[model samples]
Target: MRSLTESDIRTSFVNCSKGEAQRLSVPRDLGQLPWADLDFLGWRDPGAPDRSCLVAEWRGGLLGVTLRFPPSRRGLRHRSMCSLCLTTHPGGGVSLMTARKAGAAGREGNSVGLYLCTDLACSLYVRGRKVPESGGRLEESLTLDQQIARTTGHLSAFLDKLYA
Candidate 1:
């Protein structure tokens, strides 16, 4: 994935009003991100723990989505797999994130949800740069590049649903 600028990210959002996109926070350390290794960029909002953002190179350009999740339930710990990267996590590490559907459907309160890494670090986990809190990723016969492709494919499918 190519490195993105703040303006690029803010303008790429398809599901939110321009004002909301402008108000959303972009990562402060964009310059330090591992762009070459990323299939997409995702992060949780530091100021608003329930809010998260994701940006990816889709079709010919960038696509951004805003996501929300309920507050974590304290003392709940169980293993769950992230649908995007297939990494398993315990407790609050995985969240059921919901993104408002694009345009009119979103205005009608329609949304799409998926189990995802609470930290929004699927790219890092798939590449072995970050480890899950519980057991590691399942052993796979596919090569590292193949694993990366599978992860990206999952993400693309989810994005496709947004436009459906």
Candidate 2:
């Protein structure tokens, strides 16, 4: 992953109108983010808790999607695993994030959802830059690179659904 400018992030969005992308919140500390460790850049909108976004480099280009998730239900705690990186987290650490489908399907309210890290930090968790508070990574024989490959493979599959 490479450091991205706000312009790049805004322009990379695929499931929303240009005006909507322009209005959405981008991380303020873009320059300080751990780009080298990120499989994709993802963030939840601070002003709009239900809104989230993800951007990744795919097929020689940047692909981004805008996602929406249900509001959190307080006081409920459960163990859950991220579908992308396979890292498990306890309580509110995982979220069901959904992205509207691209093209006419989106216009018709079609969307896809995946269980993901609530904070959108799967890349960091998988690489040990960050850790899950309760649930943790499973012991596996696969090397770090192999784990990364598996994570990206899951992401690519999710992104492919949007392209369809």
Candidate 3:
């Protein structure tokens, strides 16, 4: 991953219109990001609780997506796993985030969703830099590189769907 500017983030979006991308909130901490540790950069929009964003480098180019987290009724009763980083979150830490499909399909109201970390901190979780706050267990036997690969693959699959 590389440090990105607000323009880089906005221009990288494949699923939204230029005007929409320009208006959406980009993370305020672009300069402070630990790029070496991120498979992708993701953040929640502070003004709109349901809005989130993710951007990654893929196939020699950058691709970004804007996501929406519908308010959940389950809250903390059940546990869910992030489809990308494969981290397990107890309670309601895992959110079902959806991005509108790229191009015309998106304009027609189509979307794609995945269960992911509520705060979009999958990269940190996978790197062992951050831990789930619930004092729960994440008993994965895979090595660090393997875990990173798996998470990247999952996100790639989602991007593939958007491009398809």
Candidate 4:
């Protein structure tokens, strides 16, 4: 991944109107981001909690998506999972990430919430940021290579849909 600018981020959006893309907030320190370590760049708008965005390169072109996160029920138990890494968390380190639909139809429809790792570090997880318990062993159900592939696949699919 390469560092991006606000212009790069906005231009990456394929689904949204040009006006919408121009208005969306882009990260200020895109140049400083650890691009090699990021499968995608995801961030919430500081001015609008319900609004968020993600940017990545897929298939040869840059892609980006706008998202919305509806407020959750307070005090309700969460079977938390990270959407980016698909990792389950017992009670902590998880968040709901929802993609806003493109066009008017999306605005009138309900948003979708995806459980995502709170830290939002899918790259780190894929690269073995830390042992996933069980004495630093990979899960028996999945080989280490499979895990990395799955993570990157998920990210690529998300970007594809955004640009499609």
Candidate 5:
């Protein structure tokens, strides 16, 4: 994958906000990534649980999406999927992730909780950077490049809604 410039990221947001495009993400170097396989890009904020992000590429541009994880008293439910890794769990591995809405329409606090893979592997998911599993070869269908692009697209759309 190619590294994305700040302008590229900003432009993606603009396009998605206008409903002219889908979401995308900031591109990072995929040299160290497993380029031969991947499906999406996913990552959690190192500093905040409430701040997680994803990105993907679509058409010819990048899409970045951000999500907010509010603290919830309800226990996590089973059979949830991680937005970043696409991993589904039968137990409490997923949480609700909400994206902000665009424009004045979202001025009143609107968000969504997407059941996500508990192991935030957006980066590995998109770039095929995975830890060796003891059992067998992990599902590696899409190339790392495709994973990054798809992740970026999803992310960009999500962020646009949040700030919109």
Candidate 6:
């Protein structure tokens, strides 16, 4: 994925209001981020632990999504797989994240949910840059390119649900 500017990150959210997007925080070390290595950028809000964000280059433009999860990660320790990258986290490192649907459906409280990495780092996990404390790994039959494709497809499907 290409590196993104603050404006690109803030204005790309399709499911949030302009004010909400403006109030959301962007990563401080944009310049230092490993952009070329990521399929998408994702992070949990430091100030608001329950809030998270994901940004990716979609179609011909940038697509950002705001996500929310339960505040307490208590008792989530077991072998589970991230829906986005299919990586198994032995410490129950997955969180069920929900994205509010775009437009009126969102206004009416509709949302889509999926299990994802608690830290929102599916890209890093898939590429082996980051791993759970227990050390995560996928089956050998899947190549790195195949893993990338699955992760990208999962994210794209999630985005599609947001606008659908």
Reference-based TM-score, model 6:
0.93
Per-candidate TM equals 0.96, 0.96, 0.94, 0.72, 0.50, 0.93
lDDT of 4 by residue, 33-78 (tens): 7787777787877777767777777778777777666655534354
Query: What tens-digit string does per-residue lDDT give for candidate 6 at 60-151?
Result: 89988899988544454557778988877755477788999989999999999999888877888888898776776765688889889988
What lDDT is obtained when candidate 1 is compared to the true structure?
Answer: 0.90
On the 0 to 100 scale, the lDDT of residue 29 in model 6 is 91
lDDT of 5 by residue, 8-64 (tens): 544544213534222333335444544334333446655565666654564465555
Q: Considering lDDT, which of the candidate structures 4 and 6 is the better prediction for this target?
A: 6
The CA lDDT of each predicted structure is 0.90, 0.91, 0.87, 0.66, 0.50, 0.85
> What TM-score does prediction 3 earn?
0.94
For candidate 2, give the lDDT. 0.91
After superposition, which runs of candidate 6 have C-alpha atoms over 4 Å from their true positions? Answer: 72-77
Q: Could you give me the TM-score of model 2 versus the true structure?
A: 0.96
Rate residue 40 of model 5 by lDDT. 37
Q: Kindly list the per-residue Cα lDDT of model 3 for residues 13-107, writing each as its tens digit.
A: 98878898899888787898899999999998887889988999998999989999888777565788889887788777888988999889998
The count of backbone overlaps in candidate 5 is 38
Q: Between candidates 2 and 3, which one is better according to lDDT?
A: 2
In the predicted model 4, the residue pairs found to clash are: 82-116, 82-117, 83-115, 83-116
Higher-scoring candidate on lDDT, 2 or 6: 2
